[model samples]
Target: MGLDFDWTDEERAYRARIRDFLRRELPPEWGDIARHGPGSKEQTDFSRTFCPKLAEAGLLVPHWPAEWGGADRPTWEHFILGEEMWASGEPRGAQYMNVNWIGPTLMRYGSDEQKQRYIPPMAKGQAIWCQGFSEPNAGSDLAALRTRAVRDGDDYVINGTKIWTSYAGLAETCFLLARTGGADTGKAGIAIFLVPMDTPGVEVRAIPSLIGHGDIHECFFTDVRVPASSRLGAEGEAWSIIRYSLANERVGIPRYELSARVLEEMVEDLKQQGRFDDPAIQIRAGEAAAACEAARLLTYRVVDQKARGGAPGPEANVARFAVVTADNSVTDFGLDFLPDFFSGLNRPGYLAHHERAIVAGIAAGAAEIQLNLIAHRFLDLPKVAS
Candidate 1:
């Protein structure tokens, strides 16, 4: 089949509608609030109100099945929604995870009880969830995770610590992973749990960082007890489920859309300061724009595959790396030419973008991992023997 680059008229209209909604709904102070990033308390609090309104307007989960409160809209429409929200500093906040992957993952693997109890709140935009996946020792290598969940009667006792958990300080629930099989089981030993944040022995401590307030955190689960019913899927099934979820997550952010917007803003700033005439700066800005577009097209390929009901493959890895490159390129251009803006609150957007760019390589998954996947899976390169 031939690759079609054009968006349908309906898709264009959907994109326009999202932009219109954002323009009409966002408060004047939104830029200031957004400067702290999506996981900040301000943005998280704002989303509680904002996202419900989005749901009321039928915008929160358009790609979801009608049974789940969405319109059963095409995937491209959902991708457009993501691009618009991300470009607008992600007013949906942490709930974007629900719209992007978590809710869908639950629908696929969650028990009927889990779906009825949890998904309704999410569909109504009244839920906040944190991903308890990474540990200090297992950031990208999830198979190496040490968090243990021992089965006890009808319950499981969980004891482990998660690091760099975003939105944990405010999330009402956690999508946690734990080791159920013996230490030797590797990926086959893992299990997923949907634990309520209010459960006993759950502790969350905020970690100060440049990304945003309340963004990254350390969560401790000591003797935390949850019913077996809370487990997302069958024991030893987490690796497969996680692969599906990460494919959705890896390309969901539309970070290049945000990067492109920030690049335009940087160019405007340079123009105002009479620096656009500099040939070297102009060339760098052009390179950043090209990077953003390259990332955008690569991401669209993955989205198109999803639209066709095909599982994303290593192309998602390539797209993810392209996005990181775009993010860093735009931020690097801003810092190199507009250093003054990043020093203080004057250019909150630039400051916010810079902070996110700093962690772009690390968040979602490490960029190095993406490169390895691209080398082995995408390029079909021979692996180096250890």
Candidate 2:
């Protein structure tokens, strides 16, 4: 018999260990904290407290290089940990980016000084960094960002605004992108900056969002001055660095894992209420479950490639699109059968899942972009001329 969907004993043990830790470490009010969403101030603050404890327990950053406070474990272990966290409402909050991609990005591109200054804090779960991508004009086409940074004597003067920034209201630093070249530079002129959020002239304004308060913000950097050492890579290198980070981020959240778990929860709730016996409802539930499974399988293929040290390709796009579909499928099932849960009835999990599902296609990158990539990269289809 071929090796089916079974995990190795060690892998199972690792997952069990994480599950045990969650049971022991999560506060009694964890559901309340998580209901605020991962980007909310309540959850981000809790992450600051909770993540350090995880670090001390050797569960944080275990996949990172040992030099950066990790045990140099296999990539599968890292992914398994992420799956468990996402299934449990991602108690790590904004720090998930730290372990998932930011720290790894810095490890590869950052100078010694930069790594020393940033990696240790992330490994210790003491840092919160917000992404400074997506300007008012550059949401999906990130290359269209208008933020600018001009070189000065031992410093760079940055001026631009980033919208839809998660954790900006409480982030200690921003992994920022700004055009250092002329306005026409497009992607080539862009550069990455590790800007401290507390710098003079930097401002963050909360944007009330369905996701939760404090979860999204508009960050305005007006003549934000920072030493040249803050740059993550060489001039014009932001495009490649950002691409690398996005590849890691594409499958980072394991949204399908959460969606699948939520689907089960919804079905169980329906059964308890004796509403699951209707054939119509059962068929829809099966369809939703199938969608979730499809998503999980697609994401696993990407993870498998990553485990084998392969660079991310168009498959990542397919996986991301699948995960978004799964999120929508599960959320739709809940909304159709349990409308009361979404209407201020305090079904926090359902509410959170609904909000997240609505944004899954838009966040990271748009769902349309994924379809475009699938057409051009996966199907070898010709692009239409504008």
Candidate 3:
């Protein structure tokens, strides 16, 4: 389910090193962790403990500056690191904001002092960061976020709620978006802040997932004040920064790992039940397998383009659209099977997951949105009058 892209002998050596490390370090309980998921305390504690292990092995944050406990390697190394982590189902201890989202944003916009203060702890997983973007009213349409931050001298007083906040219940700090300008702001006047969760007037309430996973949550801030230095970039620049950071994250490791894992499961189930010999099942299963591979290829293309210092426009849109379509469709063929096929799953998780998996096209960003971006931004299509 992973790639075998051609790489230099050095890249090959590095991948071997990672394999060696995982063979040594991954706990036997790794599968349990993946199934039940880690708690706020457990996940944070594990990351805090394991991150240093990754750093000691020189495999942490390969995309970041070397001074901050990172390998500072090129883009290809990232693929090896990610694939190794995924295939083993190891705890994603090092993927803290350091490798994926926050580190990149800091590299793009942080002051030197901000970088020094944040990057080292993140690289070592000694610190945890969460994102404050989604709200009850503004998830898919993220620009409608209602969190507010008003300036009072050198301090900005913030008040609002962020729902479905990833890891917020566990994180030490959050990179948050809040409105700084009045009613007419729309997307233009929102400001982002790097606010510590321990700050007064902040509350984290765990909102358990559809399957009872406690990681995602709702974070509330009321009269939480921080120095102006907490802001991520220039005033009102967040609209653009948020777009860039989020566009990168819309589909990354989760999409890759889930697609690969699901495809493998489907093939194994078919083989075990002796359905592989059925021409109908074979044709359907083969298409599912190929589609997973296609999703990975399209996703990696965006990662490759970014390595060469390109933005996400046409290529990213195409990848997202194709992958989302392939991902959701490939899994729902289970629906084509006899009802007896589902007898193996009596649990609430699988019972609900069957339906939810079909909606992947509309989950992160809808297929409709992906298509619109492709047309308006990539193909320069004119909007029809509403």
Candidate 4:
């Protein structure tokens, strides 16, 4: 737990190079692209173009194995890239999932054929993936999902619906989960599937919402049949794979980096308007910045553990909850002091941040779930029997 704040020269150099690349390559309209939101069709489509340039520059998926088009960089470098992207309003868009956990999950659990088919596109930065983990009835309690995948000789017929699916409207593939086990199987019987979004019986309907345009959707799979080869691992192996994926995915995005950057912008805006001289505003700004720093350190601990080859643990949950707090704090500060920004008066970034912050606690497996994990795992508290 000793804090080492100094970055190695190599790490510093790498980070500088990445920053330079972003400054040079990010389009002039990047702010507007980002304002459209990460899951919006504009950003997703933009990613299809932007990400390949990143891959060509050897910046995309640098942590992946060399065989999968990466330079085999360290886990810290991978997280550094994520922090930069998130802070930059995620110009990489939905492809971040491909780099973060989806590709890694496939690398760990996919069959050789599956890896060959899927990992290359992801590595090339030409893939957009949507996660089908939540449904209206089974979001937080994912094991309670009713998505069924029945074996029919060489294929499995999938029938179910997934709600709150981001980037579903334009994604090329879905990192899907469905039940392959019986009624009594529970988590053990669940399995992962790589389903093509263009497959017959797959329907995506955009849900009208405040978060962003085409950001969330209702995805219905009606008797969709895919080859059994689409399954990621063996049947009954999904829970473990999912646990692994979630562990990687949870800390993958450095949302606190974005929150911290937004706070800085808000503070600058207030200062320019002569409002930062107020004691109340300054105190709240310090509190929000401190929250962001606390979240950053907690998240760095998780990344440090990963860099040392340590497995994910309750620390990630703690970091995630801290990030949610940071997100809300920054959002609230804007709403409290810079109220006119919400009305599209002058700052569009504030509105974008507000829209995204609203879902920070709910998305990526709710903040409450993380608190429960902290209680049971970190605090070693016993769970009450239902």
Best by lDDT: 1
Question: In candidate 2, what are the lDDT values of residues 256-332, reduced to their tens digit?
Answer: 99999988989998998999999999999999999989888887888888887888888889999999988998888
**Candidate 3: regions farther than 4 A off:** 1-5, 38-41, 334-367
Greater lDDT among 1 and 4 belongs to 1
Ten-residue region with minimum lDDT total, candidate 4: 341-350
lDDT agreement with native, every candidate: 0.93, 0.91, 0.71, 0.91
Top-down TM-score ranking: 1, 4, 2, 3
Q: What is the lDDT of candidate 1?
A: 0.93
Cα TM-score of candidate 2: 0.97
Task: List, residue by residue over 1-386, the lDDT tens digit for candidate 3.
Answer: 34456678998898899988877876776544554443345545666777788877777777666766666688767767776775554356425445776787887888887888788777765777788888888876767888899999999999999987767777788988899988587888899899999999999999856432556788989999999998989888987787777666654454545556655666667688787689888787778677767767777777777777777556677777776756665556665753444543432223333433444465446678888888998889999899
lDDT by residue (243-298, candidate 1, tens digit) is 99999999999989999998998899889989899999999999999999999999
Would you list the clashing residue pairs of candidate 4? none
Per-prediction TM-score to the true structure, in the order listed? 0.98, 0.97, 0.87, 0.98
Please tell me which predicted candidate would have the highest TM-score against the true structure. 1
After superposition, candidate 1 runs with Cα above 4 Å error = none
> What is the C-alpha lDDT profile of model 4 across 1-386, one tens digit per residue?
67587788988898898899999988899888888887897888888888999999999989999989999999988988998889999999988888989999999889999999999999888888999999989987888999999999999999999999999998999999999988688899899999999999999999998888888999999999999999999999999998888888889878899999999999999989888999999999999999999999999999899888898998989998999999999999999998988885588888988899877888878999889989999999999999
Per-residue lDDT of 210 in model 3: 46
